[model samples]
Target: MAETITIEPITRIEGHGKITIILDDDGQVSDARFHVTQFRGFEKLCEGRPYYEMPAITERICGICPVSHALASGKACDAILGVHPPEAASLLRRLLNCGEFIQSHALSFFYLSSPDLFLGMDADPAKRNITGIIEAYPEMARDGIRLRKIGQQIIEMISGKRIHASWVVPGGVNAPLDAGHRQTMLQMIPEALEIIIRTLALFKKTLDQHREEIRTFANFPTYFMGMVDEEGNLEHVSGRLRIIDAKGHIVADAIDPADYREYIAEAVEPWSYLKFPYYKPLGFPAGIYRVGPAARLNVCNGCGTALADQEWAEFREIERGPLMSSFFNHYARLIEILFCIETMQGLLAEPAILAARVRAVAQPNFPEGVGCVEAPRGTLIHHYRVDEDGLMTWANLIVATGHNTMAMSRGVLQVAKRFITGAKITEGALNRVEALIRAFDPCLSCSTHALGQAPFTIRFMKTDGTILGET
Candidate 1:
């Protein structure tokens, strides 16, 4: 007889996801399927819109990372217009991207995944949440919330609105950077840095405290991909593509970011609608790769900034460098927080950040283009085709969450085997399984707003299709 276990409507993560475990006749782990449930038609609905409308239109896909979509879409517009924005425009774009990184990572690390880490994975499920987190570690919770507020402040300060679709227009950002606005952001950076330092210290202590748990918690290796600076330093907003194997070896190093079409091949598994993307060097299933902060750390040689560089060295010294487990991904995110704030500090030092040439005037003429940026969640790619009149003909988006679909499914099985037992399910076991998935901090809207469970009935059957055993 075959046995099956299902983990449904996974908690603490954005959108939805489910895990189905199928056991063979011998009852050994045989198969696991991660299902994404809802269907979103954003890609389908955007057809025939003017290219300029894409920045605002695509921003609606996910409230979590709208600037990501806008930048991606706007890069396509820059190509269509045959002009890159002025230096100040580019700097302003980087400014907004750092804001996205800060806020989104804060939500993932502190709001969603922190409950399990800080509260203990085995703690009562109903109580193991942000609320519970506040009750238990009020100061830590406050720091996290404050960090997210700073990110929101940066976004609002620059884009003129806090969340979901601020103005990052075609040639550049809609508004110039004001001295007062710069000073406001400058004032906030020191506080944000302090938050990151405190959080990094806490995460380091937690790593030592939960040594055994961290090792066993969804530990597996796969290909890693992300953008990195020329010297192979981690690059969140812009850089070249770096792909590395599980052993911390750069299998494909320094590939042009825009030329990712040459190395990426998308595969559709019969079990779900989300497509699995793999390294072209290796075949599907075999080439299953991961992308995100964890993947970014794994692929990059260093973080380039000071404190983050120190953490990077310390991170590598951890028996294993570049952390393969989902547990350390949380810490890697904190390291990124350190890097983003440091990088912002550097960018602000440049007087060009306050320049008035924020938007450039250009004639729309080109036919197509591709834009690449690393969203807080992972690497995001947006490619658009347009007509001579700047009307979008077609669009393709590779969101950060989509890059982790394979790993998410792989992680589902790993966690199910460890937590989902055959005995009457306890909330502890179910919460553990969900906690395992939330480590990915997936945004289904970026991939597709989808994930849920369907009751499955399996029975023994003969060759002629006659049922031999039924429940």
Candidate 2:
């Protein structure tokens, strides 16, 4: 009979999940599954709310990435009003989003994922935490905190709060940037740039140590997707959809955001609330693709900024074509930080960014709207239908992490097959399985819209229903 081993609540992650390793009668690993065990139904919850309130209401999705939700929601509301925000307001929104990417990526790298990268997967669980990083690599730890704070400071300067400011609105931002605020933010950028440059250099050298991981951690070929400027430059706030294959060929380019339904589709499985999004042309599982940092870099021809462009060139040189390993998300993330800082600085230097007229007032002019933005994790889409009175009738949110669900599942299986052998599983081997999922830096809380505390239970049992162990 086949036996089952379950790892409940994969540790050092944002939300609850379990990894099930199924062994055949002969005791070798046969298959593995990653289960998302919670659901909040944010989409269903938003029905009947006023369209203008979406920026505030949907911002409650997750504290870690509420700004992403707010911006996307605000953009959708803008569509309903049939108005484009003034140039100043648009620039301010982009600056806010850049801060979000910097902070969120920093958290993933320093607090959650760094422990494994620095302390080793097999290190004592007690010694594998931020405190551990602090004690062992004090300077690196301090730099992480300082860098994250810089990102947060920019958000606070512009929006008056760190997490959910509710400053974004249907047509534009609530306020304009003043000269003092702009200069203050610019002063902080130079130091942030230094940190990103230093960190990327160190991380690239660190990659040489994990030889086996570089090759097998979610490394298979697949399609990549994200937003890009008209010139095929990396863009976040506004751009057309672009999809590239693993072989470095552009499969689709300059795809209009409204036409996304023609290219992307979602699938639901009994084991998870998060839907699996795939390339519509290739169909379900076969059309599997990746998003976020690695996917963004793969789809764009350049980073658009000078420093980041140089880094992008070097990143592509690692494998000759589109980088396939999810492991490289860490590197791509740092390069983005550099790009964000540079881009934000340039926007602040423009005197027009502090213009007094930041908003454009208008009533709802459209019955439906779709908003898309490149969030820190991946591309986020917010689609809403409204009544004539401007009240929301329906909403569908395709979050960044949700888009990578299928890729994460495939990754779990590949990693399990590579590591798990025989019946006896070591803690080290199990942790490595968890580490592969972390490489995607999935925010399951945002992915599933889950609420409340779910129980974390692991069980070891046989196919005959006999319980052998439980945690």
Candidate 3:
């Protein structure tokens, strides 16, 4: 008889999800699925709200990346008002994003993924957590904690709160960067850079031990996407979109984010609430592509910083072409943290960072608008249609994790087939399946916004396990 194995509430991730593995009669793995089980209708929730309220409203979607949501929403609102924020405001916004990337990446790498790296994957479940890491590797653990604190402190200094700060607004931020805050942030940069540099060196030493994992965990060809500056360097806060194929060839360059629909489209699956977005030219499942740290590294020409540029050059040597394994996302994330810290240091030293003018106030001048940014996880896009009175009529958000749905689903199957050879699977084998998803570091809460009507069914069962009916 065929059997199904389910791992509920996939551990160590930001939101709720599960994995299901089906086995053949011979006990061989047949298929697998990664299911996102929660749904928050953020798009529909903002329909009747005023367009200016979007930045505040959408930031509520996820506490982990509220700054990302706010920035994307603010940019869309900027377009609706038909005004541009001052150059100083743009610089400040980029600085805020730097804080977000450092903290978020720290959480993903140190607290969540490091346990498996430091401890063996087959280690006791009771001991495979941050507590275990503290007991065994205290110094690394301390570095992780300090890195996240530094990131949050940077956010609070600029926006007055660590999470979901309202400092970001439609045309610009609510206040300019204070001189005291600038000096304080600049003082913290050296320590931030030191921690990431040391951590990256430590991480590189462990790569050889996980070679099997590196090869089996979603190691396949696909397209990559991210935002890039004019010279095609890595960009997060603002830039044109760039996409490259698995062979490191640029299939599209300098795409206007406002016209995202021209090159991208969304599809839905009945099993999961998350929508699958793909390159429109290829259509549906055939258009599968990836985003986030590895994708960003693969898509961009360079990091545009001293240390990071050196690291990026060495990172590319992992393969003849773009790194294909999702496992490399962990390595890519460390390099990005290094990039963010170095970038912040330069931005803070600028004389014009403290300019008094930070905002531009205006009413709605356009009926439709779009905003896009490279969120810590991947590319984030917010689109809006407003009425003459400045009230929102429709809104669509394509979150970072949503863009990787198809690849994640395929990855689940790949990892399952490689590890599970019989009906009685080992705990470590199960952990490998979950570990694959962690490599993507998905934020299910932010990605589960459904478009149109999502598929839903309810079933009643008898005590004997017979289903009554499902609708």
Give TM-scores for every candidate, taking all chains together and pairing residue i with residue i.
0.91, 0.93, 0.95
Runs off by more than 4 Å, candidate 3: 268-274, 451-471
Lowest lDDT 10-mer window, candidate 1? Answer: 450-459
From the highest lDDT down, the ranking of the candidates is 3, 2, 1
Candidate 3 TM-score to native: 0.95
Please write out the lDDT profile of model 3 over residues 1-471, one tens digit for every residue.
988899997999988887778788999977665666777788888988999889989889888899999999999999999999988889999999999999999999999999988897888999999999999899999999999999999999999999988888989998999899998999999899999999999999999999988988888888899999999999998899998888999999999999999889986656544366888887655677899999999998899999999999999988987899999999999999999999998898887789999999899999999999998889999999999999999999999987887677667777888999885699999998999999999987787665323322212223222544322
Off by over 4 Å in 2: 268-274, 450-471
Alpha-carbon deviation at 315 in model 2, angstroms? 0.4
Q: What is the C-alpha RMSD of each candidate to the true structure, in Å?
A: 5.1, 5.0, 5.7
Tell me the spans in candidate 1 whose CA falls farther than 4 Å from its real position. 1-4, 23-30, 269-273, 449-471
Global CA lDDT computed for model 2: 0.83
lDDT of 3 at 199: 98
Model 3 misses residue 325 by how many Å?
0.6
Ranked by lDDT, the better of candidates 1 and 3 is 3
